[model samples]
Target: MKALDTWERVLLTLIALVYLAFGLGIEGFLSPYALADSTYNFSEKALIALAMALLVVAGEIDLSIAATMALCSLAMGFAMKAGASLPLMLLAALATGLLCGALNGWLVTRWKLPAIVVTIGTLSLYRGLAQVVLGDQAITGYPQTLSTWGNGSLGDLIGVPALIVPIEFAVLVVAGLAVGLLLHRTLHGRRLYAIGSNPIASRFSGIAVDRYRMGLFLFAGVMAALAAVLLTGRIGSTRPNLAMGWELDAVTIVILGGVAIEGGRGSILGTVLAAVLLGSFTFALGMLNVSGIVMSMIVGGLLIVSMVLPRWLRLLQRGARPALRTV
Candidate 1:
C-alpha cells in the first residue's frame, strides 16, 4: 500500500466514487434492463482493458491486440470449417494468439524494433490475415455450449437470468487479478517498473529488459485472444472486422485510469474503474440521446484533461516552491 503514491491513491478514490455514483445514483445506469442488454459490452471492454494496462506500464504497446483477437476468432471459425472440435478450435485460437505474440516479441526484442512500430505493422498484418480468412463472410453455428457460456448467465431472475456472467467477464477478472499481482505485488513487477523507468539502468542491474518486455507482449496477446473468444460468444459469429479500432479504446481506458504514458506507473484498479466509468458514461450519454460523435468527443476531451492535470499540478508546485523559498 505504501508503494502507491499520493496521486495513485487519489485517482483510485475518485474513480471509485464515480463508479459508485454512476452505479447507484443514476437511473437506468445498472438497472435490470440495461444489465440484461449491455452488461456484456461493459464486461468485454473491461476485460480487454486489463491486459492493455499492463502493456502500457511495461513501456510497450500492442495496437495489434484487437486484430490478434479477430484473427484468433477467425482461426477458430476456420478450424470449425475444417471439422475441428470445440477443444481443437480453442487450441487453435490460443495458438494463433501466442504465435502472434511471439512474433511481435521477436520483432521487438530479438530485432530491436520499437513495440509501437512493430504492433502497428502487425495490427494491419493480423487483421489482413483475418480478412483473408473470413473475406466478406462470417462463420456461424458454433457449439451450443460455447454460446451458452458466452451469452448465458449462472442463474435466472423472474424471467431473465442475470445476463449469465459472461465468460469474458470471468476471464477478465482472472486476468486483472493476475496483472495486478504482476504489476504491484511481485519482484517481477518491480523489475518491470525499473525497466520502464530506465532500460539501460535495468540492464546494468542484471534484468533482461528485452525478455520482460517480450513476456508482457505475450501476456497481452493471450488476454486479447480470450477477449476474442468472449466477443465471438457474444456475437455468435466471426468476421474480419470484429474488434476493429479497439486499440484506441483500450489505450483510452489506460490513460484515463491515470497510467503514466511515459511508462513505469499505473494501477489495475484504476484501469478497472476507468473502464467502468467510461462504459457508464457512454451508456448514460446514449440513454440521454446524445450523438455518437459528441460522445466520442467528450471521451477524447476527458482523456486529454486527465493526462494533462497531473503535469499541470506538478508545474504549479514547481512554480510555487520558488516563491516560498524567496519568502
Candidate 2:
C-alpha cells in the first residue's frame, strides 16, 4: 500500500496528542467503554468518507451523497412499513442507492455535464423526493434485531462491559482497509490517479477515464446506502432529514487528509486517520456541552484552514529554497 508522508505523520502526531490530552484531562475519556462509544460519532461518516476519498482522488465530487443516504433510509422505512423482511429491506436500500448513483453517473459521464452541477441538482432532487414521501413524519419501530445490531456492543473484553469495539465501527475499519488496499495496491488505483492528474492525458494513455469516474460514483452511492442502513438501525427511526449536511463532513475528512482538492494526490491512510481525528475532536467538544452550531462553525474553520495552510507552507518552502540557493 501507499506509504505515509510528512503531512500524514504530522496529522498522526496531532491525533495522538489530542487523544492523550483528552484522556488525561477528562474524567471518563480514557475509559475503555467511553473510547469505544465515541466511535459512534464518526463511524458512519467515515464509511462515506472512505468512498468519497476515492471520488476526490479521481478529480470529482458528489454533493448528492448525503441526500442519497436519506433516500435510501426512506426506502428502507417504506419497505419495513410494507412488512418486508430485513434482508429485503436491505436489498431495497442498496438498489435505490445504485439507481440514484447510476443517474448521477449518466448525467455526468454520458451527458457530458459537470459533475458538480449534476450532483448538485440531484442533491436537491433526491432530498426533495424523500421529503415528499415522508412529509414531516418520521418512521419508527424498526426491527429489534436492527436496533440491536446498531446499538449493541460486542462481548466485553477483559471483563469490561461493552468495552469491545462496536459492530458499526468494526465495519468501518474493515471497509477502510479494503479501500486502502484498493487505492494503494492495485493497478486500477493508478488509473484513477492518472485520470485525476490529467483527464485528457489519461485518455490519450488509454485509461478509460469516463468509465472509472462512473464506477467511482456508483461505489460512492452504494457506500452511502450502507451508511444509511447502519444509521437507520442505530437511530431506530427514519426521517427525510436523516443525515442532513453529512456531505460536508465527508468532504472535510477527505480534504483534511491532505488529499489535493484538484485530485491525483492523497493516501487512504491519511483519510482514515483524519476521520478519527475529526471524530475525536467533535466528541470532545460535545462532552463540553458545545452547541451544535458552534461545533459546525469549528468544522468549517478546520476545513478552511486545512485547505489554505498547505498552500502557504509550500510557498514558504519555495521561498526558503531560493534563499538557500543564493547563499
Candidate 3:
C-alpha cells in the first residue's frame, strides 16, 4: 500500500519497466542473484538518503553528509591503526559522524545560519581534513572479519545460494521500515511536517522546531557514518575519496522519490522505492554495457523529468476551475 501511493505507483511502474527491459535485453540480468547483488551499489548512499529525507521534511538539508562519511571512515582508520578492536573502530566512526553532525546543527540552530550554507562549509572542511590526514595514502589491513561481514549475505552465511539476500540490503530494509514508521506514524513525525510547512506557525503552536532540526541533522550524520562503516568494511581500506560526491546522489534519489525540495511533501516509501529504482537502473545499464557518460546523462535527464512532470500534470489538472466558481 505504501508503494502504491499516487506518485509511488509511478515509481513502481518505472522500476518494473526497467527490470523488464533489462531482463529481456540482457541475459541473466533478472536473476535473483544479480538483482540481490545490485543492492550494494546504492545501499550506503540510500542509508543517508533515508535520514536526509527526515531532515528535508523538516525544512533542512545537509550537503556535508558524504564528507561526514569520509571523515568518519578516516576516524575508523585512525582507531584501527591505534589497535582498537572491531567494535571500537565502529564506535570511532560513529562518534566522528555525530560530532560533525552536531557542528552543523549547532551552527545552524544556535547561530541562526542557513542550513545549506553551514553544511556546504562543513562539507569542504570535513573532506579536507580527511584528505590532509591521509595525504595520498590509504589505511588498510583491517580485521578480516570486517571484510567478511561487509561483503557477506544471509544466504552466504547459511550456505544457501537460493536464499541470497545481501546483508546490506537487509539493513536497508529494516532502516527503511523504521524511518518510514517514524516519519509517518509518530507525533514527532507530524511535527516535522508542521515545521516544514510553516516553522513560525509550528513554533507558535508549541512545537520545538529547533530541537527537531538539530536532531534530524544529527540523525543524518550518524546514518552517513554507518554507511562509512559498511563501505570501509567492503573495501577493507580508507581512502580520501571514499563516498565522494554521494551527497548529490542521495539528494537526487530523495527528490526523485517525490519529496518537495522546498519541504513538507514526501514519503519514506517513495524515497526507498526511488533508491531501488536507481540501483536497478545503474545495474541494468551496466549489464547492457552502457558507458558511464551516457548513463549519467540518462540519469540527469530522469532527474529533470521527475522534477517537472508532477507540476506539469498539476497544471493540466487545474482545468481553469476558477471560471466554474459560483460568485
Candidate 4:
C-alpha cells in the first residue's frame, strides 16, 4: 500500500512539475493575457474530468456523460423558465442527471450488456432528448445571482480585489480531495479495484461486483450533472450541443494519467495531474493560435501513445523472458 501510494504521488508530482514548466515557459514567451484567459477552461474542464477518471478506473465507461451534462443544463433552464427558485433549479438539474445515470446502470447491470454499448446508445438518446427539450431555443436571462456561481471571482486581496479564485477552481480542489480519499481509503474502493482486476475472482470472494459498478455509474452521472450546472451558470445560457465529445476528453485524461483501461489499477492523484496537464496543454496550444483540428490530433496521439506504450513494454519483457529460459 505504501509503495502504491508513493508511486501515485510520484506520478502526480511529475505532471504538476511539467505544468509548472509549461506555464512559466508560456508566460515568458507569450503575453500574460494569454495565460490569464487560459486558466478558466483549464480549471473548469479539470473538474468535469475528475468524475470521468473515477469511472474509468472502476473498469466502466460512460459515453453519455457529456450528453447528461447537456440534459442537466436543459433541466435547469426549464426550471428557470417555470420561475423556480435557484435551489430548486439546482435540484432539478442534479435529479435529472441521476435519473440518466440510473437508467444507464439498469441497462448495463440488469441486462448484462457491455457498458460501451449501453452508454453509446444513451449518448445519442440523451443528447437527442436535450435537443427535444430545447429545440434550438436558447435559455438566457437567468438570475444574476445564479450566474455568479460560474462567473464570480474574488477581486479583493489585501484591501483590493486581486484575481479572486473562481468558484470552479474551488469545486475542482474539493472534488479532487474527495475522490482521492474515496478511491484510496475505503473498503468500497478496494472492492472496486478487485472487481476491475478480476470480476470472476471478485465474485468468488463475495464482492457484489454488479452493485459496485452500478454505484460508480450513478456517482459519475451526478458529477457530470454538477459540471453542467457550473457550465450553464458560466455561459448564462443552455444549449443542447453543450459538452459534446467531452466523454472522449475525459477518457484521454484518464489514460494519460496512467489509469489501466483493463481496470484494477489506477490512482486519483495521477488523474488529477493529467487533467491539469491536458488543460494546460490545450490552453497553451490555443494561445499559439493552433487550429482546433491540430489540438485534437495532439490529444489523440497522446492517448494512443499512453495506452500502447505500457503494453508494448510488457510484451518486450515477455519475449525476453522466453529467451532467458531457453538460454
Candidate 5:
C-alpha cells in the first residue's frame, strides 16, 4: 500500500511539473481555452487506454483496438447513411465494438492462442475490413448532435471559460473513476491480478482465467468503439485510416502509467495521469510547430525510457543493498 501510494504521488508530481513547464515555456499553453482544447487531444485515446490498462493487468495485449475503432466508426457511418437515429447509430457502434472484441477473445480464450499473436492478426484484419467498407473514400455529414457531443463544451452552463471542459473529456473523467474503482476495489480486479501473475496457478485456485480474459477483451472492444464515436463526432467524418497508429499510443500510455507489460501490476489513476502527461506533452510540442513524425519519435523514446528506467532503478537498489550490508 505504501509503495503504491508513493508511486502515485510521484506520477502526480510529474504531471504537475510537466504541465507547469509547458505552461511557462510554450506560447498559448497557459491559455485557459488552450488547456481545454488539449483535452480533446487525449480524451479518445485515453478512453481506449483505460481498457488497455485493464487488459495489460490481466497479462494480455490488444493491438487491434485502434483498428476496431476505425471499424466501429465505419459501422456508425453506414448506419447514419441508412437514416438511423442517433441512438441507433450509437448502438451500432457499441455492438460492432462488442462483436470485434468477442472475436479476439474467442481466438485467445477458446482456441488457446497467444494474445499478442491473435491481436496482431486481428489488427490487420479489422483495418483491412474498414478499408473495404470505406474504399478510398470518406464518410461525412454526420448529425449535429454527435458533433456537439464531441466538440461542445459546458461553458454555456458553467459561464466560465476556464471551468468549461469538453463534454467528451468530462465523460472520460467519469469513466476513469468508475474503472479505477473497479480495478482497485473489486473482486474481478483481484482475479485479473491473479491470472496475470500466474495463469496455471490461478486456474488451479479455481479462477476462471480464460473467462475473465474474454471479458477483458470484450470490455476493451466496447471502449474502443465508444472512442470511435467521439472521434467521428469531433471530426464529423469516417476515414479508413482514422486512428491509425493509436494502438501504439494507447500502449505507451499504459506502460508509462507503470502498468507492467507482463501484467499483474498497475492502477487506473496512474494510467489517467500518464494520459494527461502524454497529451499535454504532445499538445505542447504542437504549439512549437513540431511535426508528426517528430512527435512519434518522442513517443517512442518515452516508451523506451518508461520501460527501462524502473528496471535500472531496481538494479541500483539491489547493488546498494549489498554495499549497505558490507558496511
Candidate 6:
C-alpha cells in the first residue's frame, strides 16, 4: 500500500468514497446482490481495458478495439445462424479476433505505420464489415449457456441458492489478477516498459521491441473478442452498433488507471483499481437513473483530468523541490 503512487492512492480513496456515499444515499446500493450485479454493467469493458492498459503502457494505442468486438460478435452470430454449436461459434469469434489482431499488428510493426493511424484505419474497416453483415438487423439465437454465463451469478452456477454473486464480475477479477501478475512479476513485462520508455534504446539493447508491440496488439484482439462474447450474451443480440464508441471508454479506463499516455510507466494494480473506481462511481449514478449521455460525458472528462492532473502535480513537486534545496 505504501508503495502505491499518488494516483493509485487517490483511486483507492475515491473508490471508498463512492461506495460509502452511494451506499448511504441510494436504495439497495449496498445490498450484496445489488453490488455484485452492478459490476455486470462494466465488466466486459474493464476486461478489454485491462488489455488496453498493456498496449498504452507500451506506448501504442488501439482505437479499433470496439470495432474488433463488433466483428467478433458478428462472427459468432453468423456461425450460430449457420447451425454451429456453442464451442464452434466461440471458435469463430476467436478466429475472427485472431485475424483482426494479426492484421493490426502486422500493419504497425511490419510496415512501420503509426499504431494510432493503423488502428484507426482498421477501426473503420472492421466496423464497416460488421455493418455490412448486420445491415439494420440484429442477430440472436445464442445458446442458453451464453445467457447463463453472461447474466447468471456465481451462486446460480454453483447451486448456492441464497448467494447472488455475478459470474462476470468474478471472471473480471480473476482476469485482473492475472494481468497484474504478468505486468509486475515477469521479465516480459519489464521489456514492455523498457520499449515504451525508449524503444530505440531497448532495440539497441537487443530487446525485440517490434515483436513485443505486435504481440501486444495480437493479445488486444483476443481480449476484445472475449469482451464481445460476454457483451453479446448479456444483450442477447449482435448488431453493427455493438460496442460503439467503447474505444474511448476503454482508453479512458487505461489512462485513468495512471498509465502514462506517452508510455513507460504504470501498474496493473492501478488499472484494476481504476476499473473498480470508475465502475462503482458510474453504478451509483446509474442507480439514480442518470442518462447514458451524461455518463459518457463524465467518462470523457475523467480521461482528460487523469491525463493532465498528474503531470501538473509532478511539475509543482519539482518546482517545490528546487526551492527546498535553495533554503
Q: Report model 2's TM-score to 2 decimal places.
A: 0.93
Per TM-score, the best of the predicted structures is 6
Candidate 2, residue 116: CA error in Å?
Answer: 1.0
**Decoy 5 TM-score against native:** 0.94
- Local lDDT at 125 for model 6: 99
User: In terms of TM-score, how similar is model 6 to the real structure?
Assistant: 0.95
- Candidate 5 residue-wise lDDT at 26: 82
Which ranges in model 2 have alpha carbons more than 4 Å from their true place?
1-5, 156-163, 317-327
Q: What are the lDDT figures for the candidates, one per model? A: 0.79, 0.89, 0.88, 0.79, 0.91, 0.89
Candidate 5 local distance difference test against the native:
0.91
Residue 325, candidate 6: C-alpha displacement in angstroms: 5.1
Give the alpha carbon lDDT tens digit for every residue of 1-327 in model 3: 334437888888989998898899888988888888789888988999999888888889999999999999999999999999999998999999999999999999999999999999999999999999999999999988778667988877788877778888888999999999999999999999999899999999999888998899889889988899889989889999999888888888888998888888899999998999998899888877889888778778877887897667566557634666588
In model 6, the runs with Cα more than 4 Å from the true position are 1-5, 319-327
Cα error, candidate 3, residue 197 (Å): 0.3
lDDT of 2 by residue, 24-75 (tens): 8788987887888889999999999988899999999999999999999999
Report residue 8 deviation for candidate 4 (angstroms).
Answer: 5.6
Task: Give the CA lDDT, 0 to 100, for residue 227 in model 6.
Answer: 93
Which residue pairs in candidate 2 have backbone atoms (N, alpha carbon, C) closer than 3 angstroms, thus clashing? none
Model 2 clashes, total count: 0
Q: Across residues 1-327, which tens digit of lDDT does each residue of candidate 5 receive?
A: 234344467677777887889878987787888989999989999999999999999999999999999999999999999999999999999999999999999999999999999999999999999998779999999999899888988764466665578988998999999999898899988888888889999999999899999999999999998999999999999999999999999999999888999999988998998899899889888888999999999999989987886567566666656554563
Model 6 over residues 185-237: C-alpha lDDT tens digits? 99999999998999999999999999999899889999998999989989999
TM-score of each: 0.86, 0.93, 0.94, 0.87, 0.94, 0.95
Tens-place lDDT per residue, model 1, 21-49, is 76776676676766554556567777767
Q: What is candidate 4's lDDT per residue for 157-187, written digit by digit as tens?
A: 2334556666676777889899889888998
